[model samples]
Target: MTRGTTNPNRLRRVDRWMAWALGDLLRRSESAPVVVDLGYGASPVTVLELAGRLRAVREDVRLVGVEIDPERVARGEAVADPPRVEFALGGFEVPVPDGARPSVVRAFNVLRQYAEEDTPGAWARVVGRLAAGGVLVDGTCDEIGRLATWVDVWAAGSGTSRAGVGPGRGGVGPANAPVPHSLTLSWRLAGLETPSVIAERLPKVLIHRNVPGEGVHALMNALDRAWAVQAPLASYGARQRFVATARSLRDEGWPVLHGPARWRLGEISVAWEAVAPR
Candidate 1:
C-alpha cells in the first residue's frame, strides 16, 4: 500500500506548474484532454482539485485517479464525479479503457517509495500510455505540496526532444525541450538553513545519492555557500536574500531556470543535470 498522506490543496504547487507548462497542449487538443492522477493517496482531494484547476484552462479537462489498492480506489470512487473525474484500480501501467491514451499522467510522490532501480521502467510504462502530444509528469513533493520537483515526459513522437538538441529530421523544433521540466524548491524562507535539507524529501531516484560527489550534492553545497555569502541581503528579508542568492548562483552559471515569478514563491529550477546524481 502507498502512503496515504494527502490534503485538500496539498498539491497546489505542482498543479499550478502543470497548468502553466502544459496549458498550450490543453488548448490545442482536439477534445477534452484526459489526465490521470496516478497513485493519488488516501483521498480524492488532489485529483478533484486538479480537475477544478485544469478546467480553468480547458473546460473539458478530464481526470482519473488510479490507485493500486482496491480499498483506496473504492474510497476515491465514492467521491469521484462522472466526466470531470473518476477513480480506478491500477499501478504504474496506468490502465485506461477503450484503447484510450491520456494527454497527461501525473504521478507525484508515488515513486518515492519504490527502489531507485524501478524508476526507469516505471517511467517507460506510464510514458508509453501518453497520447501523441501528451505528457507524463513524474514528481515528488512534501505533504503540503511545497518543495517540489518534476520531470515532464513527452511521447516518442511528441515532437519534443531532450533539452539542448537541435531541430529534428523535419527541421521542426521539439514541442518543449525535455529537460527535467521544472524543479520547485518551496521552503519556509525564514528558517531555511541550507538547500540540501530538501534532499531528505527528494524522490527515491536521487534521495540516496545526496552524498559527496553527487551532482545534487554539489548543487546544494553551492546554494548553501551562495546563501551565506548573501547574508547581508537578509536584512531586507529572506525573500530578498533568496532572490539575490539565486541571482548570484545564476551569475555563477548554474542554469537557474525561472525568474522572479517562481523565485518569489520560494522556488527555483535548474537543468536536471545540475542536480542529477553523479
Candidate 2:
C-alpha cells in the first residue's frame, strides 16, 4: 500500500468535474450506476463526498471504495452504508460483488508509486472491469488540490479510435488496448502562475513525456504562451484570464473542449490527440 495521504475536499475539483461531465452516464444507467473510488486512503471523507455529489446526479448511484489494505478497508467500512456506500479489498484487478462492473472508476494518486511501465497493464485490467460506455479517470494532483491532470480512458471496442499516446515509452498501445479520449488540466487559479505549472502533476503516462519533441511539451509551451498573452485579464480575475487562455488555445487549432462555463472554473480539457505524448 502506498502512503494513504489525504485531506478533506482535497479532491473536490475532480469530483465536481466528474459529476458534471459524467452525470449523463449515471442518469442513463438502467440499474443503479456503480462508481469506484479506488484507493480512498485512510479517511473515508473523499469517497463520502463523492457519494453526496453523485447522488445529486442519480440518487441510486452506488459507491465502492477499494483498497488493497484491509486496515483502510476497515476504516472505510466503519462509516459505510451498505448497498449504498461500501468498501472492498482489491488492487488493479478490481473485485466487485456479483461481478458488478463499475460505470466509472476514479483512480487518483494511486499510480504514483507504481512503475510507469506497469501503467498500461494496470489500465487494461481495470478497464476490463468497467461497464459498457464506462470511463476510467486516472489522475494525479497536489496535496491541497491546487493543480491536477487526468486522462479519460476507455476500453477498446466498436467506435473506439486510436486517440492518445499509450503508457510508458510506447506511443499507442495495441488496437485492442484501452485508449485515452482526452486530458484534463485543472487548477485552483488563486495563486496560479503559468499553465505549465501543471506539467509536474500530469498523469503517469504524460509526466515523463513532458520534454522536448513531445506533444505534451508542446501543449505546455502553448499553454504558457496563452497564459502570458492573457495576463492582462488577471485584473478581472484569474478565472477571466484562464477563460481567455482556453479561447486562445482553441483559436490556435488546439482541440480544447468545454466552454467558458468550465474554463471559468480553471479547467481545460483537450482531445487526447492534442496533448498525447509523441
Candidate 3:
C-alpha cells in the first residue's frame, strides 16, 4: 500500500487530460462506462473529484475506487454514493461491481511503491481487467501535482495499440503485458523551471531508466534543449514558451503528439517509442 499521501486537486492535470482524451470512449459506450481508480489512498476526495470531472464527459459514468486496504475502502465507502461513485476492496485484480469491465483504469501514484521489475506484471494485471478498447493510465505527480508524467497502456487486441511497434516498444511483452501507447507530461507553468525536472516524476517503468543511453534520457535532453531554444517566448508568457518548446521538439522529429492546443495548456504527449526504455 502507498503512504496514502494526497491533496485536494492534486490530480487535476491528469484528470483534465483523461476527460478530454477519453471523451469519445466514454460517450460512445453502449452502457454507462465503468471507470476505476485503483489504489485511491487514505482519502476519497480524489476519487470524488475524478467522478465529478468524468461526469462532464458522460453523466452516467460509473466510478469504482479500488484499494487493498480495508480501512481505506471503508473510508471511501463513507463518502461514496452507491452506483454513481463506489469503493471496492481489492488490489490489481481490480474487483468492480457486477463484474463490469472498466473502460479506463487509472493507477496513478500506485506502482511507484513497487520494485521496477515488478511494474510489467502489475500493468498486465490491471490491463487484463479493462473492457475492450480500454486504457490503463499509469502516472506519478508531485504532492501538489504541479509536475506529472504518465504513460497510456492499452490491452492486446484493444485496437488502441500504436502502429508499427514491436514487443517492448509500446507493444506486447513476453507474457500478457499491456501495450503502452504514449507518454504525457503536464506542468503548472505559473512557476516552472527546466522541463527535465519532470524526470523526477516519471512513472515506475521509466523512472530508473532515465540515464545516459536510454530513450527517456535522450528525450529529456532534447526537451531541455528545446526549452532553451524557446526561452525568448517566456517574455510573452509561459504558455507561449511551452508551446514553442513543443513545436521545436516536433520540428526535430520527436514524435510529439497533440498540437499547440494541448501544449498551450502546459502539456505535451509523445508516442511511447520516443521514450521507451532502450
lDDT of each: 0.75, 0.85, 0.87
Name the lDDT value of residue 193 in candidate 1.
74
* Model 3 deviation from native, Cα RMSD in Å: 2.9
Model 1 bad stretches (over 4 Å): 156-182
User: Could you tell me every candidate's TM-score relative to the true structure?
Assistant: 0.88, 0.92, 0.94
**Which candidate, 1 or 2, would have the higher TM-score against the true structure?**
2
In model 1, how large is the Cα lDDT of residue 212?
A: 89
Quickly count the clashes in candidate 2: 0
**Ordered list by TM-score, greatest first:** 3, 2, 1
| Candidate 3 lDDT tens digits, 35-89 | 9999888898889999999999899999999999999999999998989999999
For residue 135, give model 3's deviation from the true position in Å: 0.8
Q: What TM-score would candidate 2 get against the native?
A: 0.92
| Superposition error at 243 for model 3 (Å) | 0.5
Q: Write the per-residue lDDT of candidate 1 for residues 84-178, one digit (tens) a residue.
A: 78787898878765546888899988888889999877877786677766777877877775467666655444644333221223322333323
| Candidate with the greatest lDDT versus the true structure | 3
Off by over 4 Å in 2: 158-176
Write model 2 residue lDDT over 134-228, tens digit each, in one string: 77899989998889889988766523322222232242555436778789999989988888989889998889988899989999999999999
